[model samples]
Target: MGVFTAADEERQRGVRRMKTIATGALALMATVFVLAKWAQSAGAGSWTGYVAAAAEAGMVGALADWFAVTALFRHPMGLPIPHTAIIPTKKDQLGRSLGDFVGENFLSGEVVRSRLSAVGIGSRLGAWLAEPDHAERVTAELATALRGALAVLRDSDVQAVVGEAITRRADAQEIAPGLGTMLEKVVADGGHRRIVDLVCVRAAEWLEVHSDSVMDAVTGGAPGWTPRFVDRKVGERVYRELLRFVTEMRDMPDHPARGAVDRFLSDFAHDLQTGQETRERVERLKREVLGRGEVQDLIASAWNAVRTMIVAAAEDERSELRVRARAALLSLGARMAADGRLQGKVDGWVEGAAVYVVTTYRDEITSLITETVAGWDAEHTSKKIEAHIGRDLQFIRINGTVVGSLAGLAIYTVARFFGV
Candidate 1:
């Protein structure tokens, strides 16, 4: 049985009071009938016959109406009469019919569209959302949802997915041509000159500081048959030449070495683009780099870092992400509230979505009503329905009694006047 609410109890009480009044009317009619018959038996007056007839008819009408009303909820006097207790016996049938009725009339796409269009929910919602408080509340809710989603996701799984995606994308796409094009552009724009200058400067400074080391290296590599003094003097001479070359390259922008370096880079860029062997070499290098555990770890770590940053931003109310989201929502809401065309578009979208749901799931939507009613206790259902409308039904019995009495009196008066 469904829970009997306080409101239902109040309605039941009202029904009881109306039932008492209707029963009292029936009793009064019976008492009048008896008194009228006794008066007629004592030869009181001709009007006594009319009063008896009226009272008798009133009692008959009251009992007939009462029987009809009672049969709807239960059998009269608990008898096993056919067609009695209509609701209890046919509850399932009634429920199915109710569901079918609702599906056909209420869940139809046309009905849903018409109702939603009339509501103008889009513009109204926009007006409400345009408020600062509403926008802030929505922003908070969105941030909470984002944070919850991030919390639910495992970082390791996300990292794996991100790593695999990047690896797959890298493997699928050829990078040598793109790299060659980028390098060629850099050289043409003289962007490579700064790097050349940096390298030259560094080399010159290193040679100046390591002159003794350079001499020792040259001396060590010389022939052993040569005299030690001769090797040492040759080493010192080689070191000086090396240092002077580096210093000149650093100072002169149009040095032969600098031009040679530029030509080498330009040729390498061309080979990367047009030479199959060069492209293959680059591809092999790319595979080797991607296959390294450290590189993969670095890629996965990047995703982890980004995920942590986003989650943190989502959790913080004062974060730029949240602020921007709130501002965007407020702007959208304001636009929707003020722009009639935007309002119409929003309304159309909402209406279309509602219509789609109702039309697509009409049966499923209606099944809820049928299933809920079927689950309820049939006796409780009957009682509840009676409680809701029983008070009004009692009035039918009272009306029947009064009307029956009037008809009876009129008939009796006509009979007496016509000498029938």
Candidate 2:
């Protein structure tokens, strides 16, 4: 059988047992009354008459209670008795009342606060989080959640956001002053000397490789009427001077030509950072560079590479990102377990968050209970409730029967003592 069906059958058996006990109690009381009355009619002792009276009263009380309880659940003996079968007949109204009762009493803001405070939620959270294993579990779950969120974001959406951000930033800020200031610092710190050296070396190598071309260019610039020999001689002299100048720049760190070039660059750097005309020129150059299609393509390519790397990292189990995430989790767990101050801080955070939610959305949350109850089929709701609580209520009937009988006997004895 299904689980629910088995539970229902169990509930039904309980209900039947309760009814049987109640009926049996009433029948026994009635039997006592009948026996007592017979003894009184046969001229038995006054004690027998008193006993009959008490039993008779007890029987009435028991029967009355039985009828009252039976009427709540069903019509007695299947007869159309007024006000009987109260639950089945007025189930809808009962459901609404129950819903309203729960909403007002159990779901109210004050009730929730009182209940939570009584439970010592903050301390409980602190105690739970103080465990290393619990903290590690929480951290792992958080990492998984972050990974899922990252995975859900589309590449196109990210690319658009990145592109717009870059464009906006570029449009809002002047890049030249920043660039110039950085260059000025690099120059002052001798950071640019290595670059200068590299340039000199490359130039010397190029001149050595293209000596013939250099000679041709120098001679070609000469007048057409000049003798070929004279042109060749002049070209050779010019080529040799150019090659010697490059070789000196490359080999001699303190060459006069090198010092002049360095001084010129230092002055230019200062002007780029501070001079108005120089700044304006730098700004113009920046605008021109940023306006180029190549610059835009480079920015887009950077975003693409970053996005691809992130996606790959998110997908890979052995990724540095994931490894760091796991290690962070374990470390957090260790800290939470060892440090009481940290545990308290975490607990406070949790309490604050929970209190905020309860204060802000309490009304809506409470209303859900009422709304759910109102939406339920009343008969089904009543049955469900009865299934849970009816067995317990049966005990009330049993106690009443036993107590009423004892009380009746005591009253009868008191009345006899008073000679009533």
Candidate 3:
């Protein structure tokens, strides 16, 4: 397809106008040369000789310049002259040279780094982001990006990845030590006391409400030979003692039973931490739980829940998560804008990253430029370039004509003065 655009067509028209003007000047010079020669031959004025010489030189200069300008884009007069049609014939070489120039200058690591450092991009960005409106806009854009990323992800694939990662991590690291340490801390800080108190209160309440059931359970296990009255008395006594112990434990926080319970938990925590058998049992239980299909399903479902929550929050402009994220971003931006040290750090990071990329891919980038230019059709490229610059080249022909006329007239005058 042709690459000639409307703008190129306009520029071509302008070039044609200038060309016509310059060619007309050449034609006028030739006519003046013929007329002045005839006037000199007829013994009209002595100045006619000088005029004829000037016009002849002007025509020669204009034609020479026209040939030079035309040769750049195409062969002059359609003749296959050597070194003519320079642009069309040498397009690939020119592209390579241009690519090399860019790679050596603009795409160099030093140039890129210096340019970026001078721009102060980090500080300017920070200042812009420090504004409330700018921060809001950035937050909205980030939310949109987050939603798009989530939407592109396949749930089954992500879930499988997440599930495998969790399982692998859990299997690789033993949890007994951490759990034991946490339990020990909780016990030491009396964090489990409230739980103990709750258990005691519930036990007492159950005993009070189920006295008959408790007594019956105690008496029903008596031997058949035992007297019915003795069994009944024993059951009643045992039930009363059990209810009283629970009531005391519930009412008194510093009861001996509470201390005993604390000691038992402390010992259990220690065993969990240091006892080989206990750790092995815990590990076995962990393996069993993880091996269960139900547990696997639950683990996979966790990803869905998280994805849903994040998507919902991203979609909601007024969500707590979004609001907090926006506030955090604004705060960070304000800090970055005001703190010179942070700005410098950011600038250094950006410069380093840019330098690294340019240096690493400099060859590839330059090759892309060279290959793209080489792929362009040479004839079309010549036309495109000539359209941009032909009008300016026409001025050269006009200038050459004027300068040649002046030079020729001066030479002719000197010859006449010397009586040549």
Candidate 4:
């Protein structure tokens, strides 16, 4: 379909009206010229000669203007006139010229910067975004974009990337030193006492419940020559002492057993930090854990869970993520609107970006114009252009006839007065 709209149709009608008016004027001029010539020959007033000259000149002007206007679009009177049909024949050249003109004038970096700076995009944007409704609208659009991006991503691919990244980072950085430092702090602060207490309590409870099993195991390990009753008594005694020790450790926070356990952990922590062998062992264990099928699956599944959570948050308008985003946007807009420095920075950034695009891509932009015009049918292009501007051109013809007639009359009168 043609690109011409209702506006174009209205313009075309205007052009037709102007054409009729101009043609009628020309016809009137010709009729006047004939009548005036006849009157002059029949010894009518001297003014008749002036009228004849004016009418003749008016006809000439109208015809000349009509030819000039018509030549821009098509051949005059269907004659194969050279340099006629200017638009249709030279459409490509005209397009290139137009493209060059735009490139030189409008697409220049200075022009772009000047225009954009005057527009004050930053101030307008800030005011618009400062509104609560506007902020909310922007937040909704951002959420939609985020959801779309997430949906477009493949879970498998993201999971692989995430897993690989984590693996690489972990492999690159040794966790042993950090872990050792943490352990040292925990031990020094008696943080490990709670865990020690738990173990002691659990041990005491188990010993109390499994006393008979513990005794039977001790009795079974006794010499064969010993009496079963004596072995049983010895086993009972061993179980009693074991239970007592555990109960004391559980009741006393500063028990020797707890102190010994702390010392052992402190030494291990120090070894982990200072010993290369210990660090190597820890690293190897880490690699092993990471290499496990279950761990790998866990890592991969973590991405899916995160993606789902993010998508859900994005979809919900009342979600913290959306609410926070809206709040952030509102705050930023307010700051930008109120703070001249921020506004200046924003304006500068915008102007710089615009200038960059204009300077860097101007050739491409101009080429797009040239290419589009080149692609259009030459005859169709001519008609389309004429439809837009033919009405204005017709005014030129009308003005030509009127002005020419006045000039002719003045000249003829002056000639008669001077006896020329």
Best by TM-score: 4
Q: List clashing residue pairs in candidate 2.
A: none
lDDT tens digits by residue: candidate 3, 261-283: 99998888998899999999999
Candidate 4 residue runs with Cα over 4 Å from true position = 1-14, 42-44, 78-82, 199-248
Q: What is the TM-score (0 to 1) of candidate 3?
A: 0.80
Best by lDDT: 4
The C-alpha TM-scores of every prediction are: 0.78, 0.70, 0.80, 0.81
Candidate 4 lDDT over residue span 16-133, tens digit each:
9999999999999999999999998899988899899999889989999999999999999999899999999998898899999999999998998899899888888889899999
Clashing pairs in 1: none
Give model 3's clash tally: 0
**Cα lDDT, all candidates:** 0.91, 0.74, 0.91, 0.92
User: Model 1 shows how many backbone clashes?
Assistant: 0
lDDT of 2 by residue, 1-420 (tens): 013467886896897788688778878888988898899889898878677877777777777777777677778788989999887777656656765676667656566656665665445554565565665566557656766876788766776677668767877886666777787788778887798899989988998899899889988899999999999999899989998988888888898987787688778877777789987877778677767778767776886787677667756667887667666665665666567777667665655666677667756765665566566665575566666677776666676677777888888889889998
lDDT of 1: 0.91
Q: What's the alpha carbon RMSD for model 4?
A: 4.0
In the range 1-420, model 1's lDDT, one tens digit per residue, is 567799999999999999999999999999999999999999999889999999998998999999999999999999989999999998888889999999999989889889988988878988988999999999999888888888899878887888788889989998999899999999888999999899988998888888889889988998989999999999889988888898898899999998998898889899889999999999999989988999978977887788789889988889999999999999999998999899999999999998899888988977988888788898999999998999999999999899988888888889999999
RMSD of 3: 4.3
Alpha-carbon error at 27 in model 4, in Å?
A: 2.8
